[model samples]
Target: MTKDVIQTIKDRASVRAYKPKEVPEETLEKILEAAHLAPSAGNIQPWEFFVVKNQAKIEKLTEIAYGQEWMTQAPVVVVICTNPDLSAAKYGQRGEELYALQDTSAAIENMLLAAEGYDLGSCWVGAFDEQQVKEVLELPAELVPLAFVTIGYPEGDKEEVRPQKELDEVTTIIN
Candidate 1:
């Protein structure tokens, strides 16, 4: 990887606090473009993104997400949903059960990195009632809510957090 790419990865942190300023339409589109570039299994892209800009919906999402009030402060909440049926059209059970979610995860990571590149803060949120998210977003049954990415300018400094384990402890090499 390029040094800049490595630096970007190292600098990324999940930001929960944000400024009240709105994210510009062009910037948000760029982040979404990054997500669209993420790899998919068998080239089957099964993800759908819902860019939530409404305050009331964001507040409802905060309630649905166990009252993580920080979510309400974000200017944009990108709801990444996956369609298992779309994935399963080719890979069957494995596609439905695993690949769809796996692909969505890759997309989420891309979104985080892209936000970081633009000097915007981002947080990936998974703790929410899935059913409630679907109802609140008025999603089709085929689309299952996978994750939420909140985006905005950060309010203040984020304390650096040490990795739980050393790199050697987490890696295994056979070569």
Candidate 2:
């Protein structure tokens, strides 16, 4: 049975280990579609995604990520880039400094939840050498590398429970 959105969000976890199996093309497409549908500031939608599947490139990316070897285990790694110029053209400094990153973050979150709904494992990877990633991907200067999300069938059981703050501890609702 297909899981509901709330359940999917609740079940999502950062998976560092993955099996040798590859994610199906259709499933990957669905995840991408979810990201595409994410809300963006001023509808600029400045995010771009590079789906990395080639083993050689993945290995190079692992190096760029400062030897985060676990990332290479996933069959796919999505590099999220932001076109700051696009947002800047629309909203000036605020757009370039913050909105672009915020928009891309929303897209990444959508992809994470979609991966969980598909019964796939994923982890958001933000630590990496941006210049190296741009060079490896041959991206234009305007496209700034922001993050990476690795996806695959998990190698073992779900991640062990991690502590989280209660909603009241993290939120303040205004009357």
Candidate 3:
């Protein structure tokens, strides 16, 4: 089924509860593809996407996420990592500190939107102990895990999200 972009964005919301069903390989690939297509500074994509399906590892990650039990139930978790040194390769300090993070964040949003389009449920998890996550994921020193997108089929209906702030309150026209 074709998806409407605006509707997808409007429908996007954090999905915490999930069914036991696993995400199909093709669907996961499409979600990753959307993330891969996200914009990067100077076209230097300094991000790495790690797909974690092992239950033991997911449990460890849940512990790192402050024992959020819901995380452990998801069928898969896609960790969005960033390589600062890769950004530093061309843009130096600013790139390392800022651009790399920005690039990965964009990719994370793409993953969420893509999941919504596929009628899959997802949640972007950002709160986690860095060192612990690295240990569990066996990440190298330079690769930083910025966020996680937990994916699975929704177990039930999502609650109505609070209305967003008015556009004027959050935006400004300089001209």
Candidate 4:
């Protein structure tokens, strides 16, 4: 059955385990396309993505993430980065301090939802040593590592749904 956007969003969960099979390049491209289309402040588009598929590198990343073994389960890990200078040039201090992070986050979310739409499992991993990650990836000085989104076929059935707060409980209406 085909799922709508809302259903796709609802289906997304932080998948920690995955099958051993590799993700196809075409599928990965589609997910990246969604990220590329994400909106950014002043259209500066300060985000960059690194698709890491090498087993050795993935292992290194797992170590960089403080031995988060689940990171290695996914066949692909996309590293989302922010080019602070690019955003700063366009939106000034606010862009450097906030907009760059915001833009990269939005891009990551787009990729996550797109992965869900493709019937894939993914997890957003933010806890990592930035300096180590930069060294591992050999990132330039201008690019700041933000997060890693691991993508792969899940090991089992759909992810277990966690409870969420009701809209009324979390929302505030000023009108």
Candidate 5:
């Protein structure tokens, strides 16, 4: 069997390098739509994506990400931020930390798959200074910076998928 959606899920990898070509606006719109359709806790959909295609904004984000210069080269940098006001009030502070991050992550994953399906490339960047990102994006005090996603055309052929440990190594059957 060659593979399918399940294989796509298993084969997905974080692509860091990208070609300098601009991604078409329509493709970006589809990726955003897929992200927006992601399921959320309490259907809050508290996530907001800042699609930064401007060179200046990309430069600012690159600086905020602490010299991750590759960020600026990508055609689009999507800053996934979460708004607390949209979240359920019952969960409290812990809710802010858990639900928002999880929801945004799911959205990001959906977007990455959408990109792959469209023959685009994307990477989820979570290692960054949150405060610097917030300041660069001019985010509201209530919005939390969760992750930065870089997307573009692949710079080179990704022929080899990373090796995976067999299921027996990590799974246990009980039923």
Candidate 6:
């Protein structure tokens, strides 16, 4: 049963390399909109994105990401962050930490799906130095970085999709 959404999801791959071409403004805007529309806890939607297209800035982020060179090649890197303070007024520190992180993750996924829909490649990068990234992006103190997404047109054929585990290997049926 092939469907547009399913096909997009299946086609999505974690692209580790990219061509040296800029993504158009309209396409970037649509991808950002997808991130904005993602659902959040209690509809609070605490995600904030820093769209970095400047080559120098991307290079710096790539350094901060500990030699993830592909980050620098991509046309744009969307840094998805969260403001815990937005959640703090209602819940405590735990709520601020957990919910804000969750909110940002959801937003990143939306952006990824949107990129896939546009036949663009994207990779959700979760490993990075929070403090260094904040310094690189000049983010506010209250905002916690969740993930960095590198997006652009594919440079070449994507690496093959890893084989999925069989249902018997991972799934369980509760009778």
Per-residue alpha-carbon lDDT of candidate 1 for residues 43-157, written as tens digits (9 for 90 to 100)? 8988999999999999999999999998999989999999999889999999999999999899999999999888889999999999999999999988999999999999989
lDDT over C-alpha atoms for residue 65 of model 5: 82
Any residue pairs clashing in model 4, and if so which?
none
- Residue 53's C-alpha lDDT in candidate 2? 98
Better of 2 and 6 by TM-score: 2
Q: Best candidate, lDDT-wise? A: 2
Clashes in candidate 1: how many?
0
Clashes of each: 0, 0, 0, 0, 0, 0
How accurate locally, in lDDT, is each candidate?
0.91, 0.94, 0.93, 0.92, 0.83, 0.88
- TM-score-wise, the better of 3 and 5 is 3
TM-score of each: 0.95, 0.97, 0.97, 0.96, 0.88, 0.91
Better of 2 and 4 by TM-score: 2
| Comparing 1 and 2 on TM-score, the stronger one | 2
lDDT of 4 by residue, 1-175 (tens): 4369999998889899999999999889999999989999998899999999999999999999999998888899999999999989988999999999998899999999999999998999999999999998999999999999999998877666888889999899998
Off by over 4 Å in 2: none
Question: Model 2 over residues 1-175: C-alpha lDDT tens digits?
Answer: 5599999989999999999998999999999999989999999999999999999999999999999999889899999999999999999999999999999999999999999999999999999999999999999999999899999999988779789889899899899
Model 4 segments beyond 4 Å from truth? none
In order, what is each prediction's RMSD in angstroms? Answer: 2.0, 0.9, 1.0, 1.3, 2.8, 2.4
Full-model lDDT, candidate 2: 0.94
Report the backbone clash tally of model 6.
0
RMSD in Å for candidate 4, one decimal? 1.3
**How does residue 73 of candidate 6 score in lDDT?**
88
